[model samples]
Target: MGAFSLEGYKPFMAMVTMHSILAVMNLLAKAAFQQGFSSLVFVVYRQSIATLALLPALFFLRGRSGVAGMSVSLRGFCLIFLAALFGGTGNKILHFLGLNLGNASLVSALSNLVPSTTFVMAASVGLENVQLRSLITWAKISGTLVCVGGIMILTFYKGPRILNSSNPYLNLGTALDSVHYRWVLAVGCLLVSTSCWSLLLILQVPICKYVDPLPQALWLCLLSSLQTAPIVFFLEPNLSAWKINTVTELWACLFAGIFGSAVCFYLQSWCISVRGPVYCAMFMPLYTLITVVLAAITLHEELHIGSLIGAVAIIGGLYIVLWGKAEDSKRERNHIVDASEITISIDDKEDNITGQPLLVNSTR
Candidate 1:
């Protein structure tokens, strides 16, 4: 490789920061759930808050730089609305439902499905190439399978705890344990959420290609908030549940709205603009790892042998997928170079055949 590019570094940093924020948000959201708020209410409040925060920024940026221009069709608007439906509201609702019902670690572990599902969706829609003859394609495909396998292992096998500790984070777990939920239902809900999230990522490329990411993110949040408002009002019948009772609930709403929704949505849309959905989806395992560590440290959640094994598999799979993606990029770059070289060679031959002296070699 030649000199490292700062352009490459930014996306990595963004993804890491996004995942870290999400981990903290998850913990806080879990706390808020334990604080007697329904998951639907939390999702509604989170998106509403994020929409309120991002709307002003969108208008400000729109006036100064015209950054929020979408230039999309009615169909495009429809597509965007669908994206918000799945990625924004549906994804949030399902994830929170699963998280509230199941272990946070389990929710994170299941997130490994996003990249795989996104890969399939992309290939199906012709957003991603699938070259059966290419080793890189096989690598990418196998990586996805491996990730799924890891998820299956985690789901089926709890194994022995690798490290069981009494920690400060266990307070949330203690409070949360009061509400019991079926493990299978939680897993099913999470898997569906993962699929919806995959669709959202896949759909965003077309939606954001001409549009600015910030504005697209704003629309997503706004549409999501609007869509979920009625559902929240109907489901959360207790008027008192709408009020922020504790400092923890306030922090949870604030952090989730600011970091998880606004910042994360913008970054995610931007990354998809820079590098398509598959590349962005590859970061899900990283998010999973961060959540696992945070849950362990704070919730005093046990690090099970199965989870350890699954995490290793997921990490290895992510590496393979990333390597394959890099290889594909390199191959494309080389193909372009080869085409340029061949064009130059033919032009030179034509010059010689025409008895025209080539003044200079114009190839770079």
Candidate 2:
């Protein structure tokens, strides 16, 4: 029962659920874009709805956790703004644009980059330690390299069609076939969006650990909405494009906001607090897999040989990275235990000589 319990695996379950939500969001976003919806407008509505959804709960839970009364320092506020800029608004903008240019499958297939990028970013920021001499270090580096290669394969190569076109009438073939300039644009946008997501994950670690996760999510969404509305207004200028004409468009907005933004941000913040960015990102391949299957079924998008091979490489490399982390962590725990034993031995020696016990601080 203990082995089968959810108690010890809550973080794992949370991440799986989080990515599943995101998978649905990608499909909705893709459908919305296909219907001539503007990416910027979609972002604005998504953020606005997310912010509004968080408002009532914010008031109700105000003093319970002292979250409402807590003051944000300049540094904390800056972090929130940066996170909004990159993770919330900008990430969505770029991703939606990429989705417009590409397909839902592309959006998820390339998502494997998040864990690789986050692992490196986390190590650089001192959240994760890197020991040069450790063999695990090489595994991390190699896995990162393999992950990048997998993404390259996904973007550049579509060897053969694996999943036949569900509808013979629909003519979306080898998703990347017609790409002349659009392919470059799509790949660039997707890669940059992945980087922004990685940075957002890193920034949230500290905020979620010290501050209230709920308010940070609120501020993040609110700031994102505030920041995006003006730019979208300036560039688009025409209010007509902002209109949600169809029911699908309206549904996309609500679903993306309530589930994708609000719930995802809260879940992501909690996951980051408990698991760190790399661990949180390790489930990204599942997102891609879900989107790939869903896209094929619903969108009638062709599933190709490249996607399968690339996905395998990406998932394999991800597990390699996880294995390296596990080994490194085991070594670290053993080292800590050995050091404590050594400290006790030295304390015993001093006590024998001085006839008095010596106090030792084992704080590392």
Candidate 3:
């Protein structure tokens, strides 16, 4: 039992650490935006550093089993580029901008939408099966709907202040007043980013079949840098925007690039390889909990009734989806086991029949 428990404990700890890292990254990103850094410039710098960080891995770990097995083609390259565009450039830029415009808690809460969106997108592409008759399928579908409903409520509804805290940066009243005006836009940005992330995950399902995860992630960072370069240059033409003028800005970029982007990819890839993607996904909501605590302490963020209510609904919906997935996986494994058992029984019966015939011949 101790050994059995340890297997679950180690992975849980890894997930906890990952979420902590992400929460810190969100805080740092928000701080950088508050320091007057342009979103595009930040994204450019983050992707550039992430690309560099992944460069060493590509060379040293070149001959790994998965990498050696896959053969990249022109089409595979295009898919990688598309993945970078949707997942890397689009997702990162929108997420940063959203974080810039919104509080960390809001951004974190919206992150739950990734799986829901992934489900919808996968089904759209005919990759996922949706059987209305199956309770598991209904759970997933209903869960997605509930999650979306929660998002709408959170985005549109802001009732009276449920919980207020003193913010060192600004008075609570002033901060809430400012956020009220930009609330819708910030939510829109978050939604778009979440959509891009979903598409990225969906795209990777196909891409992973043909490309290795390490090289895939490295190319994603590289291609994102390339894709974002012109956009950053056009939007932030001044050389001053490119310059890192403060220690805070430099630290934020390094954290986002090295840990948040590069290291995170490897950690998640490894976890998926070990425990599977569903296990990794089940830990996502932990990010929101960590972010909320960090934001309250560091940024003096407030909590609203709507935020709480929506968060609860979203979490409930997320659990439903996860439960459905777990059940589906169990069913699949059972199916394979049953089929193998039937095949073995048939083989055994055939062997007995042949042996009986040989015995009769020997007796004669």
Candidate 4:
């Protein structure tokens, strides 16, 4: 009935904050990779460190008794743990592997496809209501298509372009003359990683419905660490090599685990609870935009025209989806309000005819 209120504003602000933090986390991940850290080691260390950082907050906020008393059914715990496995471990592993093989700029650009994946999943799962007749919905679909098209451009259309000379960041393992087959494999990994991450959004909705956000996040991190530990220890088995190299790298890892993994996850869950999963999912491209801009500034990464166009399309599409959702919610609320007003009016008319008060008087 009313325009955007403080209640609406709060979730929007939270989403923006989450996007910014996630972008910084991406930069940190890139920086760590540039410093010669292996993708597997980076993910394991980052998650483990994040779990430790969360311990203090979990203790202080939840208290010793609350922590001890907190429990879920074994089945519920399993579901949550599996979600973390797919999202945190599986997604990160594929993403890192892809980044190792592909250009960070290209990987970052392609990551914008996450929202489209999420939207499709949400709609299929009945979490999002899609009105195909609406222009907003059409715009959203078009935008998503444009984003995909941009990715195709980046992947297929390669031409010599001016590189950013001022940027100290190297392209890492990415070489334009690299084997074409490797690029194909990397692109496949990126696609799989994006799909897994999108499914993470869908999985999270159910997990949050069953448990509190903070505990859900803590368990996810805990399970991710547990799942990764054996692989890192037994299969990889290079503890000494995993040690931090520089103070900056250590800080970057810590920040990724603490703020990026722990706090951001919690905030995202909270936002989804207040705003709905569809609304939160729509803001994902905003995070990509933040990543691109920060990569440009901090990593001195060159921007391609295709990336810019893709971003605009992604953002525009997300806006359409969000607008459609918001309008749908508005209409539903208005319908309720109108129904309430009619009921009240009918009661008032009855009271006037019967010569009795329509509303009950308070005793206190």
Top candidate (lDDT): 3
lDDT of 1 by residue, 133-157 (tens): 9898999899888988877766566
**What range of 10 consecutive residues in model 2 has the weakest lDDT sum?**
167-176
**Candidate 4: regions farther than 4 A off:** 1-10, 130-141, 159-163, 166-176, 179-184, 233-235, 331-364
Decreasing lDDT order of the candidates:
3, 2, 1, 4
Error of 2 at 195 (Å): 0.7
A best-first ranking of the candidates according to their TM-score comes to 3, 2, 1, 4
Model 3 misplaced regions, further than 4 Å: 1-10, 61-71, 160-179, 343-364
Tens digits of per-residue lDDT for model 3 on 273-328? 67877898788899998998888778878776778888878888888888888898
Model 4 clash pairs are none
lDDT tens per residue, model 4, 1-364: 2455866688888889887887787777777777777777777887888788777888899898548634778877878887888898888788877766654655665666777787778778887667888775675577667667666655554443344542323332223454555665777898889888888877876676568877777888888988887776665577665778877678778888888788888888887777776677677677776776677778877654544554465466556655666676788899989888843334556557777866768995
Better of 1 and 3 by lDDT: 3
User: 150, model 4: CA deviation in Å?
Assistant: 2.6
Alpha-carbon RMSD to native, per candidate? 6.4, 6.8, 4.1, 6.2
